[model samples]
Target: MLKILKYSFYEMIRSRWIFIYSGFYLIASMALLLLSNDISKVLISLTNIIIILTPLIGILFGTIYYYNSKEFIQLLMAQALSRWSIFTGMYLGLAAALCISILIGIGIPLIAYGVLGSAELSLFLLLITMACVLSIVFSLMAFLIALKFDDKVKGLSISIFVWLFFAIIYDGIFLLLLLGFKEYPLDKLTISMIVLNPIDLARILILMKLDMSAMMGYTGAVLSKFLGKNIGMIIISFSLLLWVILPLWTIRRVSMKKDF
Candidate 1:
């Protein structure tokens, strides 16, 4: 596993897209810093970027890598390597490369600005945490989906649609439901809705870190009121964790049953 992990990590780190992904973050971070010399504002901006880009990048990167590495995967499978080691290693390695990109891309600017010691420290950490979580969650989802479909085009399309559902359409449906049922009690329903969508859960987490629950919308406000800050954060964090784990577990199961 470690050997496969090292190889996967090295391969992913050396990929052209990894550099592009990290470069984008670096440029964005620098631009945000120049525009607003406040670390808090920078963090909030970064959070929004992470929320949007992480899933898109992860979905694309994971599926593309899985398909592109088909030959490599088959070659490894012919060897004595366990499917578990080969696959989980690739997943972890990809996730690690993404984490590095995020850390260096955003961390450099925050450190250079010398705002690491301010009250925004916690928010900064939370932003990084959520970004990393989002990366792994969607990337693993991509890998699992790719494993399920034989055709690259089909796998890619499904992965993208899955992302769209979670990242955008899910929110739209939630809003519509709320509007359609404003006359009914929706406190618990609201919490359930946000909890079901990882992106929304992430937004709530960051909003809480920014201490701006008012921006959390109706569902978020209800969640905040019911669970309060501390408990709500714990639950949201746990939910995000499940989002990360479920895909990884699915990847393992699917890889185990499917023949290369």
Candidate 2:
């Protein structure tokens, strides 16, 4: 397992796409920070961009890499290695590569700019938490595409739809619910709805860190009520952790049964 993981990690680091992805993230992060006059606004804009773009790129790049590496994987399979080892190694390798890139591209810059110290610890925790969630989400997405779809185009198409649903459509549905049930206990309803969408949860978590949850109105109030209290924050954090775990478990089951 160690050998497989090591090889997989090194292989990913050597890839041109990984470099390109990291370069793009670094440039964007720096540009956003340097261009903005307000630190809070810069953080908000960068956070939103990272939450949306990171997962999309991660999923797309990972799926493409897996499909493109089919020949290499087949050769490894022929060496009598266990399927689980190969799959786990590949998944971990891809995830680790992206995680490292995120740290370098975003984390380092934020620290260098002294942005890290200005934000509350809860905000930093939220940023790290979101990064973890993005990693899991995209890793699972890559696994599903690799295991189920033989065609690269089809796999990519599926990933795009999945990203769109989580990042855009889910928010649209939440808005509709808000409009339809304005008279209800909207605060609780807003919290419930945010919990249903990982992206929204992520957005809320970061915004809360920025002390910008007030901008969300009733939904913000619920988030504030939940995150403002110590125990409630813990519960919300654990719920986010569960989001990371469940999808990976599903991917593990699917990979195990997959013919590939």
Candidate 3:
């Protein structure tokens, strides 16, 4: 597993996509900081970008990597290795490469700006943490899709649709529901809805950290009013953790059972 992991990690680390991904964040962060003296404002702006872009990149890169390396993957499967180890190692390697890109991409500017005060530092860490977790979760999802479908086109399409649904469509539908049923209490429902979508959960958590719950609109206020910040963070964090774990478990199952 470690060898497979090292190979995948180093291989992906050399990818031009990783460099572009890292460079985008670096340039965007620096630009935002240059434009705004307010660190919180800069973070909120980056949060919007990270929350949407990270998962998209994760899925795209994961599916492309898996498909491009299909021959090598098959070769590895013929070896004396556990399928679990092979898939898990590959997934971890891909995810680790992404997470590091995010860290370096965003971390440099935040640190240079002296965002190291207790409150600001925690917020910055939370942003990076959420970005890393999103990368892991979606990349795992992409791998699972790739493993399930033999056709690269089908796998990549489904993977992208999954990202689209979570990042955009889900919110649109949720808003329609809120509008149609604004007469009743939806605090619990709202929380459940947000928890169900990792993107929404991450956005809410970051907004809370920024002390900009008001910007979250009704959903944010309800989240704060009902659960309070700390408890809400715990629930959302656990939900995000489940997002990572469930896909991983599914990937393992599919990899073990598949004929590959």
Candidate 4:
């Protein structure tokens, strides 16, 4: 397991795309902070960009890496290594690499700009938590895509569409339902809706801390009223965890049965 992990990490570290992604994130972070007059605005903008880009990059890069490394994986499989070890190692290694890149690119800048102080601790926690969630979601998506589709284009398309659906279209559908049920108790309903979408939960978590939950309009107010308590927050956090774990477990199962 350790050997497989080390090999996977080395492969990611040496990839040109990793450097390019990190560079783009770093430049964007620096530019945002340098240009913004308000620290809060800077943080908000940075968080939004990170949330959008992190999962997309993670899924695309991870899937491509897995497909490109097919021969290497097969070579290792020819040895005595277990399939679980290989799969977990690759997943963990890729996740670690992406996490480190994000930490360096966005985390460092936020910290440097005094975004890690007590006043901003909750916000910082949200950022880190969202980053972890993004990595987990995308890593598993990549694995699933690789397992389900042999063509690189098909796998990559699946990843992008999945991201888009969850990130954008899912919210649109939720809004449509909310509009259709105008007389309902939206606060509770909004909480229930959040349970279905990790991206929405992430946005709520961060924006609530930023006191921008109101920007969500009526739904935001509803969530703020209901999810303002410690217990409410805990429940939502657990829901987010479920979002990460379920797909990952499914991916693991599929990978176990997958032929190299």
The candidate that achieves the highest TM-score relative to the unseen native structure: 3
lDDT of each: 0.86, 0.76, 0.89, 0.80
Model 1 per-residue lDDT tens digits across residues 20-115: 989999999999999997788888888888899999999999999999988889999998989999998877889899999998888887878886
Tally clashes: model 2.
Answer: 0
lDDT of 2: 0.76
Q: Report the Cα lDDT for residue 145, model 1.
A: 90
TM-scores for all predictions: 0.94, 0.89, 0.95, 0.92
- As for TM-score, the candidate ahead, 1 or 3, is 3
Model 1 lDDT-worst window of ten = 218-227
Clashing pairs in 2: none
* Number of the top-ranking candidate, with lDDT as the measure: 3
Tens digits of per-residue lDDT for model 4, 1-260:
88888878888878888888778878888899789857677778878887788778878887888898888888888889887788788888888888888887777777888876647667776787687778777777788788789888988889899889888888899889879998877667777877777777777778888887667787677778767878887898788778668877887788788876
For each of the candidates, give the backbone clash count.
0, 0, 0, 0
- TM-score-sorted candidate list, best first: 3, 1, 4, 2
RMSD of 3: 1.5
Residue pairs that clash (backbone atoms under 3 angstroms), model 3: none
Pairs clashing in candidate 1?
Answer: none
Q: Give candidate 4 misplaced runs (Cα > 4 Å).
A: 214-218
TM-score of 1: 0.94
What does candidate 2's lDDT look like per residue over 1-260, in tens digits?
67888888999888888888778768877898789755567667768777888778877877887887787888888887887787778878888888888877777766677766674445655675587677667766777776788888888889888888888988898889888988777777777777767677788778777776677676667778887899877766677777667766776787677665
Model 1 misplaced stretches (Cα beyond 4 Å): 215-221, 227-231
